[model samples]
Target: MIRNTDLYTIAQSGLRASNTLLDTTGHNIANVNTEGYVRERTTFVTQLYGGVGRGTTERVINTFAQNQLRRDITEVGEHEIYSQRTSTVDNLFASEANSISKALSRFYASIQTATDEPTNMAARQLVLGEANSLVGQVGTMSEFLKTKEEELNLELESTINRANSLIESIAKLNDKIRVLEANNSYEEPGALKNERDKAIRDLAEIMSIETRQSGNDDGITMVNLTSGESLVLEDGTFNLFGLNGNPDIQYKNLELRSTGKPTSLRLAEVDVGGKMGGLFRYRSEVLDPARRELGQIALSMAAAMNEQNRLGMDYDQQLGSNIFQLPTVSGLNYAANSSLALTANARVSEDGARDLTSADYQVTIDAVTPGAPPTLDVTVALLNPDGSPVTDTAGTPITQTYTGLTAQAGTFEKVLGGIEIEFPDGAGYAVGDQFLFQPTKDAAADLEVQMTRPEDIALASPFRVDASINNFGDAELVSTTVTNTVVDNTAPFDPDTSAFDGAGGIQGPGVAPGGLVGAPASVVFTSATSYEVRDSANNVIVTVAGATDLNNLLQQAKGAPGYPAAWTALNDYPGYDFSLQGVPKAGDTFNISYNTDGLNDNRNGLELANLQNKDVVLSSNNGTTSRFSFQEKYANIVSDIGEKAAVADISLKAAEAMKDQSKNWFESVSGVSLDEEAANLVRYQQTYAASARVLTTAQTLFDTILGAVR
Candidate 1:
């Protein structure tokens, strides 16, 4: 069975196998430093029984190791994005020296200076300059954030395109590999497989993917989204994914689309684990919320300042105008399916902007019922970090549905986030139409200093108090005396001293039924033992039961008997308290009324300065009702961003460590080793030499046998 020819065949097979092994070793040595390159190993299989052994039949690739490495690559991508973006946000608010904090402090300091020197032109000018600086810086920061958002949008588009390109390349490679290995022919296409794996790794940087090996001899690998959507099919067909929205739209309003159909691929939709996921997270968690919080600050500050300034008087003795102008709400109506149009506008409610939240909301028209006044059944849902509907502790969606809304257009009838939304009456939205309301989103960018001249600043109190010129006792107005409402009545109890005309009657422009306004109610002594507080109509608004002097009578005026509960309940209830410098006679009378000296008064300026330390911002989500001063809320924003950055930095480090560990393990099993390859090179070279010698011997022996037979 062992002929000389057979020996020659066996020797030839050995030589061929040795050459293949030598070639494989050289390849390994050449590509030792290549990234994502797996070493090739020549696998030899026996030929038909009793025949020469077959040369290298295939190249062995470690699928498990490559898969593990891909996952680690994805982790690295995600952490890299998180660390970079969060750090950018943190650095923006890190310094208190020259940032928003410093600007705000300077602005308020200028106001305090103006209050100290109420009529100083230079001081008022300084306050106006500081106000301009403050608004300018806030606008700059908001614009910067808006620019970053645009950059992210462009980057997202490019990333999607890159992913699509890689997917197409991988699918093409699959076709080539499948055809090459369809019959288990000569060997697997090692170069093509390498290229495909590299493409897969590149795609992993953009978004997480799931893969499966299919087809004959594991030649065709199928890829899919983590949600089980077919990304690359066995038959070479693939699905393309994209984001649905123009660059102008905000991220929350954007949607992920697959093959022209809307799909959920937002950061919080599922466990997205790559660069794309990190970008979405940054938009929803860091960038958007920061902008909203900044807007909230601008809105609350502008509204409060304007309201207070309006209640005072400017240098011209005119009622104060708004110092800063801003839209109370921001509404974006989604394009509807039907021709029916919809419009919405939001305005600050009487409760103020401090109670507003930093989250965006969705308003959905559930139904429209016809009636004398048509009703709209609308549902509002808070968006999650990924733009999904937020859920409660019990896993139920947190939603509010308003039914029987009959208000017409031009009036904001729906209230949420301390703002009201107004809709067109007959132009109501169709079912399923949606609107996204961002109450504080653009507040900062829209904030502007409306007061152009220093003289426009309201530094004086609107109301003034005077004593009757005919009074017997020495009673004067206290500097601490403050009032929001005063009577405009022309009648006066003592026409010689009171500014108001209706000094004894409550009826006047500012006075209403059951209200304390117009002329200050007179405290008349019914007896030397007791006095009664009477209105303009001589109605006893308050009566004291105990005997008392004028000082005791005024002190008792704060509570019932001296001040009626009904008058106290009136809007902007006005009251007066006085101290007699000397004893009062039985017929002594004094006037407590409006002041026309508001033209040069600085009392309101002092009050405005006091607002710097007051709690004017509302806290959200916590069950306990709490508030924050301007600086305190700003500090919270800074701290929140810093914490997020720190956490991201730590996570990146941990992920890097994990990735390094995974890489080491993968390299140990799949990476090319130069020393090992060199040793194999020597062994295969010797085997080749030995096999050549054997072949030579077989030839020589065959020649000898032939010669002998001849």
Candidate 2:
């Protein structure tokens, strides 16, 4: 049996241990409602029983579960951060697409106006003004995107700083937990643990974190989240990382105070499939690519259109001038032809003279090469001065054939041969009529020519004319005509009849007009007319009929034809397609060619048709192909963003639900009820009283025994 004194001591110790257990239970109940507080319990063990000894109880609690809860909280927080960022980016993409659409509408409207009134100065100005507006719009949008990116960067930086601060706070909490656990303190620092948990939750929103358990020298345990190779160790230390232009997040490769080698933490290396990861991916991949695509579209449009407009025949008929103002960026070279000269003229006669009635000639450019000689066809209507079709002296109407010609260089050139004429009776004559050509094959040569007639003398005044002509050697007599004769030399000259006919006048039949004496009958003369040669746009390049030699006119008209080589040189840019597949890159160019029809009005039809069919293809340096249109690609981008935003919204809602469910579960397991805590507090207080009474009774017994021994 146990000794009375030992038994009393054992019972006293047992009573004290029971009261302490009740007090701990009361403390747990009190803090159950507190945030970040982990529910703790005392672990009891029996004290060893030896000779004359009784057993006592001991208690312990598991802290590992509490640490794990903190880590989970961090993960959820990080996910929410990324989700919010994605939402913001998606909205930006949608807004940008809307702006692009509006600008495109304005641009198309301007084009319609130009088509409606080709010659209206106000309409042309409006077209140019609208073009400017479109360019400005594109530029403004691009700048805005850049600005948004900058703002995102700033936000990312701020987040990183906050995360670092939280990490440091968590480390400090770990130190406190270890110290308290080792000392076997009766009271747990519930408030400090809660604060640390909250800090960890906030940190998780910025980046994913992994945790580990650590033991201190006094058999006390604590937890720490791992950041790269270093522990967010419980010693108040932290590791910070950042990203540059890329989306990859890098943590500082920190060396332990004792270790020399460095270890790094990469967000990519960790399995961080959360909102943080999404933000990084968007900034690095999506946003950058979108910006580049926009730049490419702008550059491509400005360069190609400007180049084509440069080659186009403008209202002034000049070449190499842009119809639209092109956007320019730093470090980019944009050389577009903006000069265009287009013009119109009334018809003229084939004899190189303007006749209101008989000489109706329609001048047109038959064909054009981007940088080569063009084909010009001039159709002349041979008619009498009375506007009636002219007939030859053989009682047949006079007819002439003219071939549309080309010039090798420039719009003007010297004619190398005379005009070939076809007449009745299988006879043909090559007349040296100095004619002025309006539109020319080449733009750089003289299209104008001048002509002079040979002098003539009559047979009746042969002696005086011959003597005077010989004396005045500047005049060389070619032929003589006798219009009035009737076998008497007293007949009047007939103005209505041909001089070649006996009833008419002298120099009849084969004689040219104006080659007669005394104004006898009617005659045709070899006269010259001059005119200025212009381009398709009507800008005067040179004069045609001003040439001294009549043969020069024919030679210049039939000069070598030019080929369309310059127009095909615009395929160097990436995504440049004769078919529209991808956005155009910088340096892309295009050309416009006249239709095979004799009219220049339908020249732009082919280009417009090509554009409509989406035949332009986009090429890349990697030899990849993409079928993207300016409008369609942008629209797709907007649609994709909207879809993502919708998905994120759904996900966020789901996450909130999940969070609510978790909170309910947590509350059920570790929630504080005021009634429950109050009841426990009252029970513990009574237990304290009972233990005190037992101690008092034991004290009285010990005192009585001591008195007996005395």
Candidate 3:
């Protein structure tokens, strides 16, 4: 073992190892600024026979740091997308010129001007012009919002395709690495692994994914979605398909499927935490809700204007018709519904005038009777936004039973918002049938001005109260207001409507009659504290007593419980009320009749103008209520969207900070360091020189020994 030839071999191995080490250090310095290049290292081990052995090149990759970077990078992607998208929506709502609040304010202001001057054509035309302006503004905003939705779909589609391509790329890289490693004695090239990691990191920008290296095939990484669905194997990709969305087809639903698998799954019903998830979250939280809230305010405004106008008389001496055409919505059948013949038709409640909301609801049908029944009862319950049953404050599901519902033979059998269950004879509604009700979705876009001319504006009250001059004793009229008046309308003014609840629920007809019943009547005061309401027959029909003054007597007349049947009937008829101020002697008569020639009466116009401040929008059946005017509701939308935008911005900044920190951590472990590489290069250069000296010495010794042998 101590021979000169052994020394030569030893010197040769040392020179070879030193030269390889210098080459590896130079390579590290050369690729120090390269993208996706991990620092390469080699181990020099001494064999049992004392010669140096070169080990395989390995990458100094910190797996935990790499994974943490991917996670933080996905969060950055999600919040960046969310904040950017939410800012756009926020600006749309916050802008004063484009906001619904400004338009609604101007529209109501014009109505107030018209109310002050009922006979002025200029004022009436101003109202019409402002209404048209409001309608145009809302229409433009609605179309813009619709286009945003379309753009969102396209963005999502492009993102999905881009993600699928990256996944495929990663899978191919996996295959290449596996093949190369298998052919190279199971030692993968560090550069090839670098490329695979880059692909997965790129995929993380699109969506959150879990990755694990499989030791079975020389450490190939397997990728999966947040749903735990396998996305990438060692050599193949599980791609996603963009299918039509349920309830809304303009959007798309993601379907994840393996390359060779027959089955597929919806790529997560919950948040997946990336750009796609950000878009989806924005749609539900900001876009759809804000759009619906705007529509709701507009719809409520239109309904109030139309209904109030219909309650009065126009300049043409006819009952005022609707000022705006109301928007209508139909119930959308859920994809899981099995009733092919049944149709769940829907509309706004009370003919689009009262008790309407902007919330998306899921209507579930609970069939209380079998298909074969003389009386088939079905209860429709509106559930939460995501189609779960609504719970009460006490955490109990508040169930209201709709009993004694006899099935009729028409399109309106078992009706709720005109839901038709026209099955064959003796067939009833299917149990568990569900429908999605976006009642105010298209309300703003579909709103139209129905009033054609200035004279169509109803400004004159339908009734007039006149104090008689014959036997009155200084009893003065303080105020006279036509609170309610029976006019010729297309439909009867029944509070219950004798019509099914159009909010996708069923109830029986109310005890009150459908049509308002009253005739022309008069109230005659017999004393300062007593009055008798007589029909047009001039005979006393309603007698009231036990009042200290005329105002108190009027107050007593308002309540229907303690009063006689004739008193209640007479007071309710004509739907008018009056108050007196001073004292009055006996036999003070007030005549109430139709105001046939009251062309300049602006009382009803003032009443309609009062609707501007009415607390009427976004109604619910809860005991506690908080209603708002039109502008307030629109402002609420702006505030809500702005809040979401602010939150997203804050979250985005935080995520980006975490992402940078993780990147730094990964870089510190696996990234190339020029200083370290330069030091190694110098050390290896010294070793190379020393080994060369040894070879030279061994060569000189061998030559000397050869000379001596000769």
Q: Which parts of model 3 have CA positions greater than 4 angstroms off?
A: 1-5, 183-186, 215-217, 233-244, 251-255, 258-260, 267-270, 339-344, 350-354, 365-432, 471-520, 539-541, 547-585, 619-625
Q: Model 3: which ten-residue window has the lowest total lDDT?
A: 498-507
**Regions of model 1 farther than 4 Å from truth:** 1-5, 48-52, 56-61, 96-98, 215-217, 246-248, 252-270, 328-330, 337-341, 364-410, 424-432, 465-590, 621-625
User: Could you give candidate 3's per-residue lDDT for residues 325-351 as a string of tens digits?
Assistant: 775555676677775455555545424
Return the TM-score for candidate 1, rounded to 2 decimals.
0.83
Best by TM-score: 3
Best by lDDT: 3
Over the stretch 182-295, how does candidate 1's per-residue lDDT look in tens digits? 756656677788789889988887778888988455589899767666778887777676665411265533234454344555323225668877787788778888888888
Best-to-worst order by TM-score is: 3, 1, 2
TM-score of every candidate relative to the true structure: 0.83, 0.53, 0.84
- lDDT score at residue 686, model 2, on the 0-100 scale: 78
Candidate 2 ranges with C-alpha deviation above 4 Å: 1-33, 49-75, 93-97, 176-194, 215-238, 245-275, 323-602, 605-624, 670-676, 699-710
Q: For each candidate, what is the lDDT?
A: 0.68, 0.39, 0.70
lDDT of 2 at 379: 35
How high a TM-score does candidate 3 get? 0.84
What is the per-residue lDDT of model 2 for residues 580-618, given as tens digits with 9 covering 90 to 100?
112222222221122112122312323321332241223
